[model samples]
Target chain A: MTEWEMVVGLEVHCELATATKLFCACPNAFGDEPNTNVCPVCLGLPGSLPVLNRHAVELAMRVGLALHCSVEPSIFHRKNYFYPDMPKDYQISQYDEPLNVGGRLDLPDGTRVGVTRAHLEEDTGKTTHVGGGGGRIHGADHSLVDYNRAGVPLVEIVSEPDIRSAEQAKAYVNELRAILVAIGASDARMEEGSLRIDANVSMRRAGAEVYGTRAEIKNLNSVRSLGRALEYEVRRQVGRLEAGEAVVQETRHWNEDEGRTSSMRSKEEAYDYRYFPEPDLVALAPSAEWLAGVRAVLPVLPSERRVDLARVAGVAETDAAVAAVVQQGLDGLVTAAVGAGADGRLALNRAANELAHATPPDAGAFAKVLRMEADGRLTATQAKGVLAELVSAGGDPEAIAAAKGFEALEGDVVAGAVDAAIAAHPGEWERYAGGEAKLAGFFVGKVMAATAGKADGKAVTALLRERLAGR
Target chain B: MALISRDDVAHVARLARLDLTEAELDQFAGQLAAVLEHAADVAALDTAGVPPTAHPFELVNVLRDDVAGPCLDRDEVLAMAPAAEDGRFRVPRILGEAP
Candidate 1:
């Protein structure tokens, strides 16, 4: 048996958050009354000419620049195909010359994925198959077309075959989504179809230089679906190769419900999309000044944000907690808390864990809470409770703590609780005094329960050790 | 020799979703071949430095602002379609997914 290595590439299509369609004045919105957003140019009426939208070009360039792609002079080509979804019977897309070329995206795990090209194109209308088996095209009574999504500007980003595993593919998409949202290019909500992904997967023998036949998987609605589709496709392909059968190159549809990949269309049935330069639109050569303006406005991307946060938090940038904070856009709050003299590690952990569900509180208020925990003014459990209140309702952290009755336990009060715990758990305390350090946790739990979680665990441990030494 | 064959014409017509008669296929093949022959004559010229032209006019960056304008009425647009239902254009059963 030979070990097989999977090679994967991805095509991510993101809709630009523009006010109008790419080539017309139709509104570029989602979830409206089906055909209300359609105009003559979007509906492909006769005598309708497409004029390029300036903001769409700017947003596309913003994505390209963020990916480090070099802007180039590009022209639109009419990709002719007969589809009911496209009212024009063709899609105006960049062919030989694309706007952005030769870029790279650095995944959070330090894997650099090469970006081939991110070209701008118009999106097609959505079609809903009626009275079909599972609303599929086959066995359908008819299909309904909603032109709301048509003519929306989309940037189709194609990645090189640098991905090696399903986990890496998900990471790549996650990082890409973060960058998209960070740069304000797209909302990148995969569930709402603002962002779409198609994975091209192939398998080769381990250490083999040549590649194998690849299958392109479509309809991956989310990052999880992308991972599952690739995993299933890799197994299917490797199974065929092991059986001395050949892998057929084709486009496969990912059935999320069935957890399998089925052939949508083989290469033999693939359409011949005859492409030619679109005569209606002119070449798009962004001016040097315009590119400079876009580049200047590019925000610090998620990868760099992770590095900055990790540095501020005194942790490795590759730390999972750091990645989580940056991905959730809570790094700013964490950084501010650290700047306000809160312990870096504690601030990051709370933001990554405790604040994961709640709305982030004010930086100063959050830092005050962390300071209380660090300075022994509040126990860890009490601090978490205060943070919950602070997140749910905006208020001063100190006032919230006071109102919640989470005051710092006096030294004598904690001592009394520890004494009571030792008396109640005599056997456990005897074992702890007899050098069973593991019994420390047992005593601490008793003290915490007795003190209503107001006594600090460290204080309880210290008192227990002191009594042990006296004995 | 003809530049294009009858089979090539038939394949192109099929791709375009056009139903062409056998006689029309032969006729269009000859006509397309003649057009291709003329292109070959132009391709034979030795103008190496001339850049390829995508459009006739020497214009670039004909753009519009991002402000949205009015859209067509749904009732009027759907009225023009051959079939419509549920505020959408109703078409026959689609063959396959979008390319």
Candidate 2:
């Protein structure tokens, strides 16, 4: 049997976070009353012209810089097509001269995906097929058009066909989303349709160098859908090849509910978008000074934040816990805690697991709690309780601990409890003293109960081992 | 010889949803051929250093701030539409999904 490999490329469309539409003053907002945001330019009325928005270009350039792309002089072209969603019967987009030419994104797993181009374009309006069953256009009576989303500025980032697996595709999208949010480019929310993905997938023999006919999958709403769609499409192509059938090149729609991809259209039906330079707008040649200004303001990206956190926390950069903390933007809190003399591993564990749920607390206050745990003033259980309170209600960590009676039990009291636990569990104690290391947990549980969960498990283990060695 | 054939004209008319008569397709093909010949004459010039022009003006980066202004009245806009329902423009049954 011949092994097969899947080759994938992605095109991600991210809506720019701008106050106005791309070419007009109409508000660039989502979910406004139908047609409420329409202006003459956006509505494609006669004698209306489009003026490029400066901030939109800057935001698009920021994305390019974050992805390590070179910003170049570009111009817009009218991608002519006949679709009701685009009131102008065409879309203004970057064609031959795109803004950002070559870039690359490094995923958390150290996979560097090459980006081909990220260009500026205007978004089309939304259409709802009302009279069809399930709102599909197949059987619909008529379609209703909403121009609220029309003329919104978008940056379509096209990636090279470097992704070889479904997991890489998902990772590429995740890292791209993080970069977008970090650079204040877009919200990057898949659910809100702010960020959209279309994948081109093909299956070839594992060792073959040449490419195979590819199918482009659309309507992947989330990262999970992108993965599933690629997997399904690859399997379907492999099945066809095994049965002596050639894989037809086409555009497939990913049905999330059905978990399969169905043919939408083929290459023969593809629209010939007669692209011509948009004459209404002038060429965009951003000065070198302005490019430097955008580069200066780019924030610390997620990958750097993960590496920094992992370095300070003494964990591997590929650690799942490290990724979680960085994804939730809690790495700063963990780093600050480590800087305040708290144990690195403990601070990271707590921040990734517990702090992820609650509102972020002051870094200093959080570090103080971990410091108490490290100094044996509070057990792990008691320290967790204190951290919870610190997150919920703001106060000095010591005061919160003392008011909750989490002051460590006197040494004598702990000793007494340890003695009582040994006495109560003679069989377990004898086995433990006789070098049954697993019996240590039994004694720790008893001491914890006796001290009302205040006793530190680590301290209990230490005392047990010492006593056993002495015996 | 004409640069554009009648069949080419027919194809473009179909794409644009224009129901042109057979005679019109032939007429427009000849007319479009003349226009292409003129463009070809210009393309034949040898001005090696001259850059291609996209617009008449020499201006670049003509831009506006990202501030929104007032929108047109939705009611008046919808009133002009041939069909309007539920605060949106109602068009005939779309042939296929948007590309």
Candidate 3:
């Protein structure tokens, strides 16, 4: 009902894609039988020492650099808290020294979101509250806990209240997800609970000097939910301010179904989580050489890849944006395609729009198919076919295309198909003669379909025009 | 004196759903107090222009080739659920309905 300025910040917890847990040999995996993938180290059993997974640290470093963060030479800490989900009772997390500090991520809207800190921590187990006949945990019989995910490597990236709107929050997550994927750090899958987001939302009157009290939205799993939660919280705060009431400091639950945020509990102001130097692990100062090595392997950021694809690949902005959306390195995809003798522009189109469209939901796998197509052995059409095959039957694009008799056609055979198609389609031939120039697309389609896309598209287009002109 | 009192420890323990005894509560109060006291030095660092660290690693994305593969079997993933009344995972009555 009233105008307000929303101030938003985010704490994003992304699970690193390392084979082992952050501090244990237990596999860092989901979909495993509960407790099957866990061990004494992850269970926080006594006498179990923690071992730092170097790969996780490298991934954290890689992510920091992609976000333009100044990677510290060293960082480590402990966050103390007792919970049923945490086997150790205290989570081994960075308090003062984190993997990355002070970074900025550019959104497509041309806004830069400031990153406050990205630190590494082990994940706690999952808890399921059981309530009895009353249907509430207040008088519940007991609770169920699953420790399979405990001690999993996690990097918490905190943003400096730079976000303004729900869209901005969503954009931040998307961009961050892109960067994480580029670095091969984490899967960044929200549904599998590999990536989680918590938001701090506060609103002040249009002219208010100091910021309003903030409410923290706990345990938001998806970027869309993160955006919706922030939007609802901002309105709720503004309503309170208009009614001559102050925004209460508390933790809230995002009722996604209701599209609103409800207070869960009064917020805790700096209650001490007894953080200490983890005695099991010492200060791990990353060497500059180690960082340089990681840098060499660093995939280009989505934004930089977009520009590179636009320039070298000569792709349109919309096409480049599609590749950026999947966070697949545009240059890499283009290079691979060109190596396979496919044109850069053609590869970009297939990678960005065509493959992106057919991917349906698995953006990760779609990007992979685009890469395979770039190698030139598979036609874009065949790549699409492989994508469909992958969607149904389980096989690589080359293997699938090869089995389906959809390999790319080379020189003479492609030329032969072009000649044959022009000779066959005559009525459409009359349409092209009448200055219906768009009919060229129809001929190209017919030739390509007849040849099964084995012919070079450019060669077909050029030959079709020459023959049509003679007619 | 520990900065984390029994009341504070108990309250946080309750929030996180940790059922601790009086003896463990007192022990945690002392341990937590010691830990926070050590962290007090974080304020002393002169960060005038120094940005707060968020991520220590580089920001490059590790991309997967856009190809689909077999994902976890639904039954295999959900088999170890503490409570499974149906195809979906079930737990004690939840604190609040999913949003």
Candidate 4:
């Protein structure tokens, strides 16, 4: 394959985590019954005007500030188009003027990607096509528009064409998602439609000064798909260029199952949204005090949290374990465990290995579990058992371990079990002591069986070593 | 200048989902050109120091607190739709796919 460098830019839209919709007082929630959250303003009824949701603006501002963007005065514009998903004939979004402009995202490898702008917009309703080819829009019998999500607030972050590879694009999104969730601006769930990505990919010869014509891949829902789609698009463009075919600039759809992209619409069919200033809404001029307030309450960001984890958890800065804990949102559990006098490494290990799940135990209870494991009251396997029990039935970790007969055995009891195993199997013990190190595991198993598996394997091993030395 | 052509009108009509005849497309082309001509006159003005105006009024930060308020009844809201099913607005089979 000829050497080529890919140029990629991302447009990420994240729904703001707010209590109500962007323009109306309807509840801004997910998975509710269809159209139950709609109001006149959200439904775009005649004679109805929008009142901007203050929390949405604040959340958008929070996201911008967290990304190191300068907040400025912004205005809303009516992007006129006709779509059934949009209850109104147009969508209210930001145009030339946006709330924040000019930011940068620093990936893990220290490459900084510049953010062109991050602006606020309202999400359109969802359309579920029925009675088609596997429920697709083509050849569908009809479509249903649920207005519950029509007026939800969204912040569309546009990046500069500085990404060189698909991995970089994925890292940029992961870091951005962390910041959004850390600051409570958005849930940033990719599986749900709360966070959506559009990738514009182009390729050129190595060391080229100018970029090639780009194709925009729309609706890359997952992070994996985002990277895969970019990779496939780059290869497609490169193939076209190598085969003496010109790459056409258009919108493409990523068929995830087929692992390829097909053209959705050509450039000529692009909708020229006649955008004009929204007359009903006013300018969003965030004052100095308001900006300061939002900034002051901003939580510790993901990068800072990773540093803290490295320092507290005693993990290497480049350790994948530290990144996994932080990325999985298990940093709080680690923090609580360390604060409760648990060993940092042990706490991080337990949390990363055991507590990494969709619903982890509360931080306080998880801290107790880690502290117990640290104090040697519970062995590693016992700690895992306690964690599982705690998840299914919330209770004290120590008590759960005790109920499961996982308590640490006394030294004398373990010694007694070792003695019984030795007395019962003297020939095996003699052979084990006769230069067969692997037989130590056999003896340990015998002792565990003698004690009904209550003896710590380590303690049993220690007792067996001493008895064999005396022999 | 013939800024708005008949083809442009037809494209715009297609985007707007308007089913217009050939005569209507031609007529709308001339009318839209007149509108654009008036907009061009306004754009030709020398207003270097003037900032862009998003709204005619000088109001800023007209926002409402994020509070839950009463919503219209589902039945009442669905009653106004031309076609509704399962408490949602039903429409013709959509041809375009979501992006």
Candidate 5:
């Protein structure tokens, strides 16, 4: 197989979580009664006009700032096209100018993908095609348009063609979603279509400068589908290239059920949108003071949080345990535990692994569990149990620990368990006395089992060594 | 300069779903060219420091509170549509895929 490289760029459209539609006062909600959210403005009645929503603009700016983009003077345009879903013949979108331009997102693997622009636009109404094969548009008998989502505010973030693989694309999207969520700009829910991805994929030989013809894969509603569709498209293009056929540039739709992309429309059939400046909406240029205020209010984002977590935990920046805690949104619990005097690494591990699913206990309770484990008041297994109970039912950690019978064994109790193990496993003990050092682990396991894991492993080892040394 | 030709008018009319006759296309072509000529007259002006204007007014950041106001009754809105089904506007069979 010849070496091939994939070049990918992503256009992510995230719906702003504003309370109303972009140009109208219709409630910007989803999954409500189909046509209940319709209004003259969103329905595009003849006399209706658009008034830019300030809250939507603020949300868009918050996204841009989070992505590290420059917020410039942007204007809306009428992208003239006709569709039944859009009662207006044209969509009100930003053309030559956009709210955000030229930002960069750094993936977890340290690949910097440049963002070309994040422009504001309106979402079209949904069309539920009926009597079709699987209800797809191609074989549908007819379709119904619900104008509820017609004027919902959207920010389309277009990335520079800098992604090298499907994994990087997924990482870029994950980081961007975190940023959007951190800044309270969008929920970024891919399942609900609040966040959608369109991937532009092409391939070339290794070290080639010019790219092969690219195919755009649309309607990648989830991150998993985004990566899978890009991979499938890249392989298809490489297969065509190796077969000595020229790849045709076209827009393709991802048939997720089939796990392949099918041609939607060719570039030859592309529409001439005839975009003209929207004469109703005026220029949107934020003053320096306003920009500063937005910047000041931005919450600490993921990248900064990662560094802070590593520093606070006294671990390497690439520590998987710390990274897992931060990625799972459990960094707050870990931070609170560390602040209340729990060992940072212990807190990170327990929160990331044990308390991952359960609700986190109070800060002081979590810290006490970690401290108890550290001070040898509880065995590691017993500490996890206490933490689990604390998560499932909020209470004093000590009371829960005692109630669960997780009390630490006294020294004599551990010694007695060690003697019992030695007496029961005479044959294994003989091998251990005959200079089989590996048998130490066997004895330790037996002692832990005998004591129900309440005895410390180190203490058990010491007692076993003392008792078996002379034999 | 003839900016709007008869063919151009016909193409735009088709896109706009406007079924115009040959005579109507020809008349509208000439009228659209006149309108373009007037726009060209404005383009020819010496406004070196002039900024591009999106609207007639010099307004920026005109916004409403995030609070949602009253929505029109669904039945009333659906009644205004040419055809209504299941409380939604019913159009002709859509031939192509969604944009």
Candidate 6:
């Protein structure tokens, strides 16, 4: 609890959303049947040639651009290692010549997490270390290997230890995940191991510039979990330092069940996996024509789009942020809304407040409905209704809402409905007149309920107050 | 490259998660040093201001309509799992946890 500062950085190994493995033609789909997606190139069969998946390169480039990193003519290198799952006995990864360097991830609070480097690599196959409740190598049983995920494309984003707290680390991951998924380079789903994280959490005396020995906590799968792991590690290190014990640098594993980090192993126990240039694969320093093609295809990044949303849509800063998170080209949505003759400010307000809060957890779906509603084919109420009707309907929202007759009613019709509700709710009406204006909401609800919410609530509220208060 | 101690080789290899024999570790110390020395060639490139490139494709958002796309069939995706119990990928019971 003392004033110790955390010097934290992160290494995020994101599985690119490439259809095929990083250096092979095998399908890169997650959750495939074990080993079924493997091919000669990925499985490392003798005499098989490996080719880079073009999508992997593009994805790494797009992410590089988004992070504001210089896209170098990066090259790949081979990292040799002997493990049960790594069939090649060496993983083909980038070392010195990474795709990006000096990039930054900007938080909502405007803190920039400096990017050390982002590199491309062919992922190693996964291994299940089977054994009794003991150490892995000393007393482990036979291991089962899954090559299905072996050749998946991966981009390892390494950040400078610029983070100061556990919360910032979490925000960094969340923001990075949002940006990556927004770029469409990856699904960025941690639940399914698409976005895997490892943190280098260290500490120093309250204002000391020198850092203490850091522990690397591995296999963090979620943003919240990453934050918790960092917090737990920080506390443990602080406790160790307080108890006159020095923190040793080592790799630790996050036990999600216990919400803490346990020592996986230490540097004293390691052996060399000599790294060298990969001979089988040709060096892929892209030509200018190719880089131009890739750059031309770059989507508007989340931050830039957010700024545009504020300037072009004339919405407040906070509202612009929500639309920018994963809806990368949300500026297009506003432009489209405006092109359809919808008021830009009104569309943004409705989309951010009403439509945003009501957005399905999946952002991609929310944007489509907003577009349809903004075009005036469907009303705001109809949009909400479509979301509800199609919650399990497995059909399109606009079509479903139209089928259910939930489109927005005009201003005068809403006023008439308000008149009718007053007559029907005489008891509530009496309460309002008898110094109980709090019942106003009840009457408004009655009108909405009578019309089945086809009326715009704002217009209905205005008309209700004008007629009911006799103004 | 000068020869490195087995201990140093072992230490670096361990950081990277490779269980190497003593001989392999020694061999790798030489190889790693040579690789690092070779990598110095990249630093020798003439003029600066060259941005390191990470990818080689159009960096646009491949936006898809947010309709629920088809997911893998439960039985089908799980069919390839080494072990599946109760609709999840089950591994050998892991011991010890974060304290």
Better of 1 and 3 by DockQ: 1
Candidates sorted by lDDT, descending order?
1, 2, 4, 5, 3, 6
Tens digit of lDDT per residue, candidate 1, span A337-360?
A: 999999999999999999986788
Stretches off by above 4 angstroms in model 2 are A268-271, A410-426, A429-437, A463-471, B5-7, B20-30
Give lDDT tens digits, candidate 6, residues A286-371: 66676778778777666666666666666654564444432533456555665655566755654554434332323344455666
How do all the candidates rank in terms of TM-score, highest first? 1, 2, 5, 4, 6, 3
Chain B alone: TM-score in each candidate? 0.92, 0.92, 0.72, 0.83, 0.85, 0.64
Question: In lDDT terms, how accurate is model 5?
Answer: 0.86
Candidate that scores best on lDDT = 1
lDDT of 2 by residue, A175-286 (tens): 9999999999999989989999999989899988988989989999999999899889988999998899999898888889899998887754424677889989999999
Cα deviation at B43, candidate 1, in Å, is 3.2
Clashing pairs in 4: none
By the DockQ metric, which is better: model 1 or model 5? 1
- List, residue by residue over A227-339, the lDDT tens digit for candidate 5: 89988998899889989999989889999999999998775343478788888788899999988888898998887787888888888766777667877888888888899
Higher-DockQ candidate among 2 and 5? 2
Best by the DockQ measure? 1
- Computed on C-alphas against the true complex, the DockQ of each candidate is 0.84, 0.81, 0.07, 0.65, 0.61, 0.05
Q: Rate the local accuracy (lDDT) of all candidates.
A: 0.92, 0.91, 0.71, 0.87, 0.86, 0.70
Candidate 3 DockQ category? incorrect
Q: Pick the candidate with the highest TM-score.
A: 1
Which portions of model 5 show Cα errors greater than 4 Å? Answer: A268-271, A410-440, A458-471, B1-14, B17-48
What is the RMSD, in Å, between candidate 6 and the native fold over all Cα? Answer: 9.8
Query: CAPRI band of model 4?
Result: medium
Off by over 4 Å in 1: A268-271, A402-405, A410-430, A433-435, A449-452, A462-471, B21-23
